[model samples]
Target: MAAGEPQAKKLKLEPKQLSENVLFGMGNPLLDICAVVDKDFLDKYGLKPNDQILAEEKHKELFEELVKKFKVEYHAGGSTQNSVKVAQWMIQSPYKAATFFGCIGKDKFGEILKKKAEEAHVDAHYYEQSEEPTGTCAACITSDNRSLVANLAAANCYKKEKHLDLEKNWKLVEKAKVYYIAGFFLTVSPEAILKVATQASANNKIFSLNLSAPFISQFYKEPMMKVMPYVDVLFGNETEAATFAREQGFETEDIKEIAKKTQALPKVNTKRQRIVVFTQGKDDTVMATANEVTTFPVLVSDQSEIVDTNGAGDAFVGGFLSQLVYDRPVTECIRAGHYAASVIIKRSGCTFPEKPDFH
Candidate 1:
């Protein structure tokens, strides 16, 4: 059923059934070095405004230069990592309610990333590789556009046997009932993603993922397809849903049509129906299941309150998952998601308050 917003519930909230490591997520780990610089700085490093690319050999010195010259701030940024952090924040009890697996380096940056994740209460078990330094994405913000150049040094060095495949680590995977993997990991380690996803299907557990970005669908279609059959819940935004529809040859422009078709996509887990959710910023959020599609309107009282939308999407999924692990209704899940996004967009990064007054 469509809703102006998720229906308000009068019933008292149920007691939480959450336990440690109830939610599991894996993705690329990066220390985002964010700063604003002049156009001359972009030209100096052979970069253009509004372009996202891999750091080239010529740009190896760019991260150091940005830190030395610009007033930079570091944020623990990886799509899956951000979502996992938000989920834990929303849980607010049973500390370390979320377990996160990823590869980072045994370096100072890696240490900083560990500290940041711990501060958010996320149980991050990083595979600290010795061969490489660490992964970083330098966000160069100009007045007009933000240019991102990512160097997935140690992040790209993830070995399944060293982490996911290890019996000790697999125990964590077995312990969790729900799993979320960001689409960005499709670039780093599709094989590892498939392993975890396949386990979820075999064990009759919940598996979900985000489209991450339009380029993920455009460039990583093969890896994306390899894991789609195991996806029980899929999330994306308007453009991402549209781009994925095109990549999958759905041949439709209507989001509702795209959503329904995506919802009906092939899945190995026949035990549960797949849910396809697409958010259109302040517009209506679309959620489609095998039976019907529902749209929930988002109300923004004062557009002036939104300071940044950097991790809104991640917060949405995080909020959704926070409720989902406890078996809440989908409508309530969406409601919490909207609430979480609203809170995060008002802040600079993905940070939330001491506790959520979301009841």
Candidate 2:
């Protein structure tokens, strides 16, 4: 052994005291520019066929020219941000929420997000960076309200040092009863996730996660594996769940096995209850806890019309979290989640229903 060698200190986590009502989220904040376009518009813009495209200024200019031929709308978006917004609306109870993220140039997009948060009564504190333009997502919608293009940009710069002050923001995180995170962030910057997860562990936080996109699972196998033990509640759809199962070397066909394996993961704290919730479109949603497995049937409106499916998953997470934070029964929570998702699917974009009449 070298006598003069420096030694690395072992990381230690001590639980901090926290209230039972606050919630905090960490992720990217993006602006969504949504528009309904027909085949003519698609052809006029020369938007390549299939999957969303992230374009440069030239393409954006061309897109702008094409959109001038149709109608367009803009809204604030980002998976975690949307979830927090929906949760705030559904809870209808006074709750404190803090979001940590980077925004580009105090532009209209950033202003709109701040205004929307304020309108929803959410405490909006953000760090504005100057290197890049504010991030945006151009959602090209068809006449049927189905999204054909999701152009993402600028929102991809959330790095670890960007969250170095997170502990100082611990008051905001600890004041909240639950901490929500999205898998998309993990894919973007796992170091940022590790920073948050370590702090949440030390503070005895009820950590929750949503699989933001189906394909996120494929790119984040190791990172997800490392983060799961610190997670208290996990939300995902069928595609995400199957991807997770495959990543863990389990066959998707064996649902029971997947559930069992997921439930058996070590908990961050023994006193905490761990759960995995899988949402199957039009099929029953399944929840797995250490000692029990429950299935809740999806609630479908008698004459439901699909307007737009964007943010539906985020709405479901918001609904579930709103109920769960209040210590509602799992069954009721699942129902609330489905109810929220149903409402969003019948709307043009990610929006809260005027009323939560979940009978």
Candidate 3:
């Protein structure tokens, strides 16, 4: 306690800067080629509705021939890409998205996807794989804008060794207030998830995970277990939640028991600071956190007219993270998520809601 004899300088560490409204998404970036076709088109190709067919070289050639027989359109899409797009639109703010993937050809489709990201006001930082073609998901639509078949390609090449740019972009993950990741990416490359999760956790950054598809859970059980401790918020539908619960020895029918088990799962690395939100189709959403569990009713739309349900879950994550980045109350975050999902359900694709009238 020296008074005036060259007092030692006191050092203070500055608090981490958190973005108020910016949201960051990490996943595959692909183009969605939406083709509106009639029954004749399906009959011509012996294709069934609501089926996702994998395309190889022969299948891709056949698809090209079929496209020549029918009219089609294109949009920028990817599970996480759609999430960031909706977030920017709903919040009407500058949101940033960083994707890790590699593509073989530097073609127009790739350029267009990058342009679309810019147009959506999302900061795009992608690593091109000089060996593989860019990934795409062909969504065949009916006259009513209902999707029939979703052909996923190029997205399969999202591997770990190809994404060395991730190291360069580690700063993006660290600087982000909230990091949104899709489960599909984890299924494709679990090491990428570990890298991002470890960095985000070390920086004390908020982390959110989307169960992009139910089938992904089947393939990603071990990887999911490894990253669960780093996750702070989890987004998934009833099917995905039930699958995860079953893995933990809970029955699907006993949703309450499932929720309890979900809440009680041990953190993988650090102290438990997590929330699990289980969304059911038009049913009440069940949320479980460490200290509390609750349900939030879904905002019902007129049953007469329902649109595509493609990116509803992604929109919900974006809305939830939008509020969470600002450190808003958990209740408000839930409400905002519900509102975003409602808007997307009323549209065809991963459309965003109107500017949030924050009450």
Candidate 4:
């Protein structure tokens, strides 16, 4: 033993916490440029309320108009990033609790996104791609509706071989007890998603998935189905669940029927049955497992109290995943999800309150 050597201190986690208790997420990363606009503004720009459309070069004019005419706010955004941020906010551990990975350009927007994520207590592992500019998502919010237009420039540069093949990165992936990937990534890197899902299954980690949109469920069914067998917990909104069911050749949009079929899908390596949970806006939320189905009514919130619905579902996933990592019951997990969603809807553009009161 060398007497002059510096010693590293051991981190002592709680009894319930382990090396694998950390959460890791992967998806496109975007700098959310959010502003309030009128329905007329949407019509002028040819945008449909509540629809998320990928931005093209032609949409640059609309973005310029937004920045010129409205009050704009920027935040680190993307479905997976939002969920990971909320999970970090809920978990509240001094050591790293949640980590996210994606691609970003070597530009100002990329720098801003990474800084904001660190401020939210999330470990931001972003790759800097030089070929394109940083990505941005413009969110147009109205009194009762929101529309998103995304320009995924460098965000789509993440590749399985260049990013995920690094030995150091693979070590980090193997250490996570839980993993989450937004469905949007299926279009960009289904290979990476499959690799992570396979690893989670082999190691008995909880792998979660969010059906990002109805279009993804309807169009990207094949890749999603390949990964579903490895998913331990699955989330979707009513529209996504229905769309997935119909695309899979089911005859009904009934959530229970959808859940039953989803739950019956084969699982890999996991001994416990898969769980399917879908939320129906303002209606009862349903959860189905191999054994039974349970439904809980959405906690009532006045229409006037709801300010923005931009990141409500992402917040719910964050809350639920935080609880699930701690091995909470499904009912408690759903309650935590609802609580978090309730808090987010009162704010604008995926922003959180001062502190999350989970108690």
Q: Which ten contiguous residues of candidate 2 have the minimum total lDDT?
A: 8-17
- Worst-scoring 10-residue span by lDDT in model 3: 9-18
- For candidate 1, the per-residue lDDT at 69 reads 97
Query: What is the Cα-based lDDT of residue 79 in candidate 1?
Result: 78
Candidate 2 wrongly placed segments (more than 4 Å) = 1-21, 39-66, 95-102, 143-145, 148-152, 162-168
lDDT of 3 by residue, 1-359 (tens): 57643444432212223343345676777777666567766665566554434454544554575468557566677777787776666555434433323332366777888787777767776666545566776666564344333344455556556553355565565556677888877746678778777767776777778765555666677888788778888888876877777666675666655766776767654553778888877898888887677988988888656666666777787677667766777888888888887887677666654466555
Model 4 backbone overlap count: 0
Residue 199 error, candidate 4, Å: 0.2
Q: How far does residue 326 in candidate 4 sit from its true spot (Å)?
A: 0.6
Per-residue lDDT of model 4, residues 1-359, tens digit only: 56433332223433365343288999999999899998888998789888788887678798788889999999999999999888888787744688888999998989899889889888778878899988888999988578999888898999888888788787788878889998988978899999999999988888999888888888888899999999999999888898888888889878899998988888996576799999887788899998898998877889999988888889989989888878889998899889888888888888887678877
Q: Which scores higher on lDDT, 1 or 2? A: 1
CA-RMSD of model 1 = 6.0
Per-residue lDDT for 213 in model 1? 78
Candidate 1 has which clashing residue pairs, if any?
A: none
For candidate 1, write residues 189-232 as lDDT tens digits. Answer: 99999999999999999999899878899999999998999999
Candidate 1 Cα outliers beyond 4 Å, as residue runs: 1-14, 36-53, 57-61, 141-147, 299-301
Candidate 3: regions farther than 4 A off: 1-22, 36-66, 69-71, 95-105, 141-154, 158-167, 268-272, 353-359
In candidate 3, which residue pairs get closer than 3 Å at backbone N, Cα or C atoms, i.e. clash?
50-148, 102-129, 103-129, 104-132, 104-133, 135-154, 229-268
C-alpha displacement of 17 in model 1, angstroms?
A: 3.0
By TM-score, the best candidate is 4
